[model samples]
Target: MAEPFPLAPSLWATTAPPGPETPPLTESGQADVVIVGGGFCGLSTALHLAERGIRPVVLEAREVGFGGSGRNGGQVIPGLKYDPADLVAKFGPERGERLARFAGSTADTVFDLIARHAMDVPHRRAGWIQGAHTEAGLAEVARRAEQWAGLGAPTRVLDRSETARLLGTERYLGGWLDGRGGAIQPLSYARGLARAALKAGAAIHGQTPVTGLSRSGSTWTVTTAQGARLSTERVVLCTNGYTGGLWPGLAQTVIAANSFQVATKPLSDNLRRSILPEGQVSSDTRKLLLYFRLDHTGRLLMGGRGPFREPRTPRDWAHLERIVGKLFPQLDGTAFDHRWCGRVAITQDYLPHLHEPAPGLLIDIGCQGRGVGLQSTMGRAIAQYIATGDADSLPLPLTPIAPLPMHAFHRLYVSAIIAWYRLSDGGIR
Candidate 1:
């Protein structure tokens, strides 16, 4: 039962809107459903559930968006680590097609929700670019573009010249653009979701951590660290990277790795016009990828895999700073305004997991570094299944939680793998 690292002083903190008022749960009461964790998934679940006239209650360990939802790079890229064809090959046509469709349009789910709610979050939907660092990388993105285009996605392959023009960097050999993806001020989006959820009659309790839970036949009971109690017929565990031992063996199901990020101060007008001029986010194809984008205000942000343990020094972000200069030499002496990190849950098979370890309890965990869009879509699907009790309504079927063997040592190996990948990717020492 470990707590998450303290919230990082990220760029989002200065830019995001104020969180809505969320009073704590005082008296013991029963709810139609109780959701754990108040990141993107939990708030979206509460919002969608309340829209359906359900009395949902949300219990958050910290203020809303205090975890990865607020700390991530905010690139709204769709699809999973796997491609559409691979999804069909692995899960078969029936379930695979459904999963592919759900995964592909996850970005749409976020944009649509923002439009439907009129959330005043700064966002853009130009596209997401996958830069190819090697010839093989170019082939891979071309294949990805072809597969997604066949599925009617507005994806296209980019030659070397086109890539250099769009990305303002010749570091990539070539790449592809998936027009369905985009970027956002992640913390602002999370706060907006909380506002919409509260307006829809949902009850959210911030700083109320669920300490333990027990079930008796049809109902489940949860106790919080604040000495409050709640009962519900259904409980949804939306904790992703910050998951603890709230449920038996749940924390061990995925490896929570750190994704470190840095944001530069607003660039000069010439630099801004030269870098990511069209406003699409870009992530290169490397063992440990480098993802970057230009915010609407012209600040350049970059992120990548980092230390397994929480960062302890400014040196933890030196690699990203060097990589930025390598990619955009014009930014060599630019000053960085923010540096932070958050945990991203990586499942065994690199896909989102839905588990029903017990009756009347559902769990959604693991995002593989794409939580913003996937979790938003997952919330709507989980809400539909909760309201209707139809497993088919869910994008993925319920699976048993299978904790990784020797899960305690994941960090040891994960760190080693990251080191090897970093070396292979090639950069300053």
Candidate 2:
């Protein structure tokens, strides 16, 4: 087995403004709703419910945003991994249109919340770019732009020269730009959400790992490893890729994948100006994808798929280092100051899952690396569902939790899939 890789000190952890400290749940408590997990989804749910006068108690295994919420690349992507046409084909016309509209509104939701709360996190709305890494990739980008534009999304296709100028490299054939998208300091945003939720009258507990969940009558009791429990009328489980066996079959519903990132120390002014001059965040088209952006401190962060097993050493980011070197030879010797990895859940259909296995039991999982914008938006949607008890108002249908077949072999299967993607990525390049 790979050695356990715990969350490490990341660029966001050190640079972003610190959030208010929250006390752990020491004794039993009661609230209208209990949210398990303190990442973006849980925190956002708590805030929205509190806004509706519903006191929510959020429990986190560690500090707020300790999971992929704080660890992700921080790009506020405007849509799902799949395109608008795929959504239409999958859900038919009406539902697909709603989902696509909701997807496009994610960036607006994130920035609006930040402004309403007067958050001080480093943020920018320059735009989001999806570069085409292969000849076929350019066609995919155009198709996506065309489809979303037809649906009134702020999308535009950039030819090869424009793509190269925007990204500062000729590694792409062309790309698409989503004008509604942007970037932010993820950890700072998570912390800001926590503070806002607290001010709105939500109880947030850190270091409170939920051990068991059981229902009695209409009240659901949540037991924590710290011997603290809470009884509430509803429960929202927001533990995505880091999901364990807390609730039976929840973890098996999606495959967990590792995404690793490396950040270089602040670059020189000249280098910064020459690289990604427009301040837009970008990710390329490849099975083994590459996402990168400039931090507030001028640090360049590059992210891609990591080893299926926990990284035994920092050398695991060497592949990312090679990509950076090749893409921008001027920064070939630039030293990486930070390297870390986090799990992102991927559903079979590549769409975020909204599961309601039992009465008062709700789950939102499988971000597919689009959690930064999607999670917060989904949290608010889930809160609306809990407040009004209207499933039709949600972006995605509240369906039964369907566990994958032969889930016991999921680890092996994921390993093989990663291998295939890596090989396919080489062919694309």
RMSD of each: 2.0, 1.9
TM-score of 1: 0.97
Candidate No. with top TM-score: 1
Candidate 2's C-alpha runs over 4 A off are 1-5, 426-429
Q: Residues 17-49, candidate 1, lDDT per residue (tens digit)?
A: 788887777788889999998999999999999
Q: Estimate each model's TM-score.
A: 0.97, 0.97
For candidate 1, the per-residue lDDT at 259 reads 93
lDDT of each: 0.91, 0.89
lDDT string for model 2 (20-115, tens) is: 887889999788999999999999999999999999999999899989898899899989987878888989999998899899888988999999
Candidate 2 lDDT (Cα, whole model)?
A: 0.89
